[model samples]
Target: MGKPAPRSFAPSPFRVYNPPMSDANPLTRRESEILDLLAEGLSNDEIAYQLGISPNTVKVHVRNIFEKMEVQSRTEATMEALRRGWIRVPGIEAPQVEASAEPLSWPPLESGWRSWQLLVLLAVFVGVSLFVFWPYRSISVKVAGAPAFTTDSGSAVGVVTPRQDAPRWSQRAAMPTARSRAGGAQIDGRLYVVGEIATGDTAALEMYDPNLDVWQRLPERPVAARGVGAAAVDGKLYAAGGCAGESAITNVDRYNPGAQMWSSVAPLPEARCGLALVALDGRLYALGGWDGGDVTDTLFIFNPEQDRWEEGRRLPEPRAFLGGVSFLGQIYALGGHDGVKQRSEVWVYDPADDAWTPAPSLPESRSGVAAAAEGVSIYAIGGGQGEQPPLHERFDTLTRTWSTIDSPRTGPWRHAVAVVIGPNLYVVGGWGGDYLANNEAYQASHLLFLPLGAQGLQ
Candidate 1:
């Protein structure tokens, strides 16, 4: 490799992304385990005792974590770990760890008073352990098709049911204005519906609060478009390549959920509609869609570091009105249409090799199916050919096989969107018979599941 070109702009110091880290700087499993502890506000001695190791040994692991994560202090390491999904802080919001001129102490405490305090804390923990049940969120698993959880076509689940089948797809509060063909994705803990609404629907950005089972409206996207693609990365939602009136457009709109604001980024090279998008390795990939005149196979990738788009391998077949989801670190383009006919081909793209591979075809030729990945499996939700169905299928990456799962109650639909957050796979607005404002959730049964803030233990 040669010296890289100099940068035109500098990103913020707090920025973290999914760029491939160099293999030359790697951390062992033990080091990653220690970093997880550190993110929980554990000190060196506390981590050492928890893992049945010496304080000095834990200190060595912490040093290695700093070097590999390229962070000089514990706070930086924790934030980086969280951004990278290497660690998760459950039950509580992430603590604000501000930057300081001086790094923190190794164990963070010293001398006799702290030592006696630790001993007293240990005794209290033992007593509490015996009398109170620990949080079971960590050990529970989701059960598919639990009768205990149910939702109607247009109604939302107002209560949380504690049963053997914990994870399920229950309808949430319907959108105030039911519309379809809109772009949707989950950013932060809320689900955002963007893009084109039904002909008379005034609101462009609609948000759903799953916990409260209520709907609230947000500001519309910067650009007015239909047939756009949506994916959330770096905590920002990017809506790219949809139709602007009769012409296909290359315009891109970015919205920050935190600031409730909109901005622009580099647009796609080709102005296209009915595109599919997925976020992998902290980057965005825009796949096949329809130009104003014809369907296209071109693929463009967005690099956040440079805010630029680089063209990649073309799709094996030109597709539009398709669905896509990233599973096991690769993008899978599901069934789609070529202007006139629906397709069953399963095309997978490997970012590492920059190549496309054909996987098993859909059980049946279908288009406009919504997809979401959980663990190693990707579920193709309700979609079909000329006459759509309520049926969806599951594809397992590990086995390279496909199986038909019970269809969602959403019935036949097209242009729907699905996103995975925690254990629930949230499915939102699409054209089901007519434009829909419904939001439904799906979760795998008999699978290990851990949701944020789950209380009580088995």
Candidate 2:
């Protein structure tokens, strides 16, 4: 009868097909095979090749496997499979799917679909709640406070609270030597105090660690000096022009902390003290300072790679002891004395075009202030009227406006040095009338100043 219908190889209808059921009781037999292969770290192509199936078929199987396992990623799927005893190794035996003896059926499609819908709805609900309920958050900071200035009609010298939060001045740590009117530079995170007026003609190099709240003595300068301008390029700290003993110095010295040694490098174009040295755009810019006698308008840039100094655009208003900082790619020269008068003038120098532009002036005219750039704001702290004003001002670069911060705990004076470590600013070694070695750190709420939001909300 037509070759007996070609004797089909299909199993008899009475023969039973028994497939392994997972303890989690959801995945189908084929889906379990696909997941097991996935757990073996085989990609779709490799899985398809091993299974003798098309990559498209593997993809469809993978999607179905994910839905059945309720996992988004392969790692999650593998983890779930292992957790639920859905997989077993060659040597290891598979755990029993269920303690109950009844044969399990696949979970209802409607139930799985409903669970997925519930998850999506929950996610959407949480996201909407977060967006609607938590739009903006408020944070308080301790900043140097605004000074209370009492002007003397002709030439007013006012007492300013130097430390913002506290009424009484507190010392943080003492420097190895008493220093005043020093050059300070921060490299990496270490605060380096280069040259300052100490007991003797001091060349003492002191380093302050903010993390430890301690000071360590570094190798002394090659020549005992003060008023030396320091800047870091790459990893090397360059100490430039200052006075050695009582004489003005042009000699530039380089310090290697790793080696704990010092070496002399190329000298500055002019011997200067009270000048500003800052590293901007990979080059060190040395701004206005005193050249033994007169205040200099001389601006020079040093290239560490070439070990040379090139003339830069000079400050429009010549002044020594000016606070200079590089912010938003521009060098800002703030409050300083021009020999005859204390200046509130703020000037910005752009290296790209080599031009100087006047910025919004400081609220108070003071020189020898400690200027530090934190984010987009520059803080002019504890500067004197000419020598030191008991004044503190903060310049917001974004707003181009100046706001007076609360005064420091110490009296109004300058020659104090400030360096920003993390979110806190440390003011150290300032002079009020006589040279002071006291150190103070502002941390509490009283020292913080919060800026207004776009909507004028604090």
Candidate 2 yields a Cα-based lDDT of 0.65
Clashes of each: 4, 23
Pairs of colliding residues, candidate 1: 136-456, 143-445, 144-445, 169-441
Off by over 4 Å in 2: 1-171, 385-389, 443-458
lDDT of 2 by residue, 1-458 (tens): 11111111112111111234533467666666677655543445445545656656977888887787678766577556655656533323443565577867767758666777779967975565335322110001111121111111112212223334553334576554445567777777878887654232457788888777677778878876656677777777788877554456788888888888999878888887777888897998999877766777989998888989999888897777788888879898988777776788999999998999999988877777688877667888877653344777677778988876656554656767787765566778755533445567644223334566322111
Residues 1-458 of candidate 1: C-alpha lDDT, one tens digit per residue: 33223212112112122223542326677787676555433345345545766656987888777878898776577656655645533322334456688876546456445877889977975555323322211112111231101001121111111112223556565565445456777877778877754332122787777777776667788777767788889888888877665567898878888888888899898887778878888899999987877888989999977999999999999988777988777899998877668799999999999999999988888767788887667888766542356556788777888987654453455667777766677877665544455667766543445469552121
In candidate 1 the C-alpha lDDT for residue 254 amounts to 85
Relative to the true structure, candidate 1 has a C-alpha RMSD (angstroms) of 23.6
RMSD to the true structure for each prediction, in A, is 23.6, 27.8
lDDT values, one for every candidate: 0.66, 0.65
